[model samples]
Target: MQQVRAVVAKAKNAPVSIETINVPDPGPGEAVVKVQACGVCHTDLHYREGGINDEFPFLLGHEAAGVVESVGEGVDTVAPGDFVILNWRAVCGRCRACERGESWYCFDTHNAARKMTLEDGTELTPALGIGAFAEKTLVHAGQCTKVDPQASPAAAGLLGCGVMAGIGAAINTGAVGRGKSVAVIGCGGVGNAAIAGSALAGASRVIAVDLDDRKLRLAEKMGATHTVNSRETDPVEEIRRLTGGFGADVVIDAVGRPETYQQAFYARDLAGTVVLVGVPTPDMKLPDIPLIDVFGRGGALKSSWYGDCLPSRDFPMLIDLYRQGRLDLDAFVSERIGLDDIEAAFDRMREGDVLRSVVVL
Candidate 1:
C-alpha cells in the first residue's frame, strides 16, 4: 500500500478536502495508475451532494488520464509506463453481453478487488468505481485503455466520461451519419460533444438548443450549424423550421428532463431517432405523452450508457482523432486546476460557463 493525496467528500453537501489516503497495491487483474489529469465532472458533485447515494467519505473524480505505475499478475492488457485513459466500464469477457459480442453493454464491469482506504482505515467508495482525483489510484487492469502519448492528458481525460458519452450518443446510439439532420437539446459539455460528433459523422445540419446563449455559442464552436435559444423560441418549432419543416432526422435530449425530452420527441421527423444521454434523478418520471404518440413515432428511443462505447476500441480511435486535429478534445477543457481547487471548480460548474475544469496532478 501507498499513501497519496486525494480529493474526498466526507459528508453530504460538504466541501471536498484533500486528504492522504492509502491506495493498495494491485491484486490479481488490478493495476495502479499514477494519475496525470482528471476532469472535475458533475457526477463527482452528485456524489458530494449525496444525490448518488449514502456513499459518504467518497473518493470523487473519474474522467481521467494516467500512466500505469504497476500491475498485478496476469495483467497484460497494459503495463507500467503506458499512458492511458481510465474508464469505469471494464468489460468482463465472460459476461453475456461479451458472449454476444456486445461487450459495450457488458452486464458485469470490473473494478479493483481490494479497496483504497482513509488514514483511519475507513473504506472509500470511489465515484463510478474510479477515484482518479488522487496522485495514484488502484483499478482493474481492463479499466485503462492505452492511448497515444502525444495527446494532452487534460484533453484526453475528458474522453473518459462526458465527452465520450456525448460523442457516442450521436454516432453510436443515434447512428447519425452523412446527410442526416441532427438536433441536440441542452448545449452543455455532453450536448456540444454530440454536435461535434454529428458533424464528424458528416451530418448535413446540426442544430443546438439551449436556454443559455453562452452554451449555444460554445455549441457553435463545437460544430453546430445552427443555434436555437429555447427560452426565446419553441425548440421543436425552430428545429422543424430549420430542418426544411419536417424536423431533424435525429434528435438527442442531452438535458435529461421531461420537457426537453418532449421537445426532442416532437422535434424529430417521423421515424427519427431520439437518444437520451443526460441523467435524471430517480424521482423524475417520464413525461405524460400519449401512447398513440409513442406508437406513431416508429423510430428507436434509446438511452446511452457511457456513450455505448467499448473503451478499448473507442479510446484509442478518439485519441488518434484528437491528435490528428479532427476531434477538438482540447476545446472541452475550460481550465486546468490542481487537487485543492475542486470545491471551487464545482461551484464554477454550476455557473454553466466552464465546459470542464480538469485537475492536473
Candidate 2:
C-alpha cells in the first residue's frame, strides 16, 4: 500500500477536503500512475453536487497526465517511467462494440478493482474511475495512453477530456473537412476547441458564437474567422450573414441548452450537419420545433461522447501537433494550482473566470 495526499468530496454541495489516503498496489490488469498534473473540470463539480450519483466521499479529478509508476501482474501495454495521458474509458475487447471493430464505443470499459481508502479505512469512490487530484492514482492499464514527454503536463492533461471532446466533435462527429464552413455555438473551452479542430481540418470559414466577449476573443486566437456575441445579437442570423446568407455547412451546439441547440439547428445550410457536444441537465427539454423541420433539415443530428475519440490514437497525434506548434493546447491552461485549490477553482469556474485551472502535482 502507498499513502498519498488526495482531494476528497465528502458530501453533496460541499467543498473538497484534502486528506491522506492509502492507495493500494495495482490489481490484475491495473497500473499505478504518479500524477504530474490534472485539470479541474465542470464534471468534477457535478460529481460533488450529486449530479452524477449519491456516492459520497468521492475522489475528484479525471483529466490528467502522468508517469507510470508500476504495473500489476499480466500488464504489458505500458511500464514504469512512461509518460502517459489517463483516459476514463479503458476499452474492453470483449464488448459488443469492440467485437464489431468499433472499440471507441466499447461498453465494458474497465477500471481498477482495488479501492483506495481513507486513513480510517473508508473506501473512496473515484470520479470517472480516475481520482487524479492525488499524488498518485491506480487505474486499468488500458487507461494509460502514451504521449509526447516534451509537452507540459498541464496542457497535455486537458487532452484527456474537454479538449479531446471539442476536437473530436468537429473532426470526428461533425466530419469537418477542408473548405467547409463551420459555426460553433457557445465559445467556451469546448466551443473554442471545435473552432480549432475545424481550422486544423482546413475549414474555410469558422464562426464562433458566445455570450461572453472574452471567450469569443479567445476563440479567434484558436482560429475562429468570425465571432458573434449571442447575448447582443441573434446567433443564427449572425451565422447566416457570415456564411453568405446560406448558413454554415456545419453547426455545432457546444452549450447543450434547448435554446443553443435550437440555434445550432437553424444556423446551418440545407443538408448541413449539426453536432451537440455540450452537456444538458435532466430538467432541460428539447425545443418545440416541427417534426417536418427535422426531416427537412436533410442532415445528421449527432452527439459527441468525449469527441468519439480513441485515446490511444488521438492523444499521441494531438500531442505531436502541440509539439509542432499547430495546436495551442497551452492557451487552454488559464492557471495552475495545487490539490488544495480545487474548491477555489470550482468557484472560478462558476464565475467563468478561467478556461481551465490545472492542478500541477
Candidate 3:
C-alpha cells in the first residue's frame, strides 16, 4: 500500500479538502496509474454536493490521463510506462450489450476489486470509479486506454469526458454529416464540443444558442457559424430562420433543462434528429409535448451516454486529430491548476468564469 495526496468531499455541500489516502497495489485484472492531468468537471461538483448520492468522503476527480505504473497478474492489454487516458466504462465483454456488438452500451462495467482507504481503514468510493486527482490511482485494467505519447496530457485528458461526450453526441448520436445544418443549445464545454464536432463532420451551418454571450463567443471559436442569444430572442424561431425557414438538420441540447430541451425539440427540421446529452435532475419533469406532435415530428429523440463513444476506437483517433491541429482540444482548458485550487475552481465553474480548470500533477 502507498499513501497519496488527493481531493475528497467529506460531506454534502462541504468544501473539498486535500487528504492522505491509501491506495493498494493492483490486484487481479487491475492496474495502477500515475495520473498526470485531470480535468475539473461539473460531475465532480455534483458528487461534492451530494447530488449524485449520499456517499460521503467521496474520492473526487475522474477525467484523467496518466502513465501506467504497474499491472496485476493476467493483465496484458497495457503495461507499465504506457501513456493512457482513464475511462469510466470498462465494458465487460460477456454482457448482453457487448454480445450484441454494442459494447459501448455495456450494461456491466468493471472497477478495481480492491478499495482505497483512509488511515482508519474506512473504504473510499471513488467518484465514477476513477478518483484520479492524486499522484496515483488504481483502476480496472480496461479503464486505461493507451494513446499517443505525443499528446498533451492536459488537453488529451479532456477527451476522457466532456469533449468526448460532445463529439459523440454530434457524430455518433445525431449522425451530423456534410452539408447538414446543426444548432447546439448551451455553448458550455460539452455544447462547444458538439459545435466543433459538427464542423469537423462538414456541417455547413452550425448555430450556437446560449444566454451568455461569452460562451457564445467561445462556441464561435469551436466552430459555430452563428450565435443566438436566447435571452434576447426566441431560439427555436431563430434556428428555423437560420436554416432557411425549415430548421436545423440536427439539434442538440447540452443544457439538460426542460426549456432548452423544448427548444431543441422544436428547432429541428422535419424528420431531423434531436440529441439530448445534458443530464437532468430527478426533480425536473420531462416537458409536456403532445403525443400528436411527437408523432407528427417523424424524427428521432435520442439520449447520449458518454457521447455513445467506443473509447478503444475513438480515443486514439481523436488524439491524432488533436496532434494534427484538426481538433482544438486545448481550447477547453481555461486554466491549469494544482490540487489545492479545486475548491476555488468549483466556485469559478459555478460562476461560469471558465470552461475547465485542469489539475496538472
- Please give, for residues 157-223, the per-residue lDDT of candidate 2 as tens digits: 9998989999999999999999999999988778888999999999999999998898989999999
lDDT of 1 at 352: 96
**Candidate 3 residue-wise lDDT, 298-345, digit = tens:** 899999999999899899999999999999999999999999999999
Which residue ranges in model 2 land beyond 4 Å of their true spot? none
Q: Each candidate: what lDDT?
A: 0.95, 0.93, 0.94
Write down the worst ten-residue block by lDDT for model 3: 116-125
Put down candidate 1 lDDT per residue, 304-346, tens digits, no spaces: 9989999999999999998889999999999999999998899
Q: What TM-score does each of the candidates earn?
A: 0.99, 0.99, 0.99
Query: In terms of TM-score, how similar is model 3 to the real structure?
Result: 0.99
Error of 2 at 343 (Å): 1.4
Point out where model 1 deviates above 4 Å.
none
Which model, 1 or 2, shows the larger lDDT?
Answer: 1
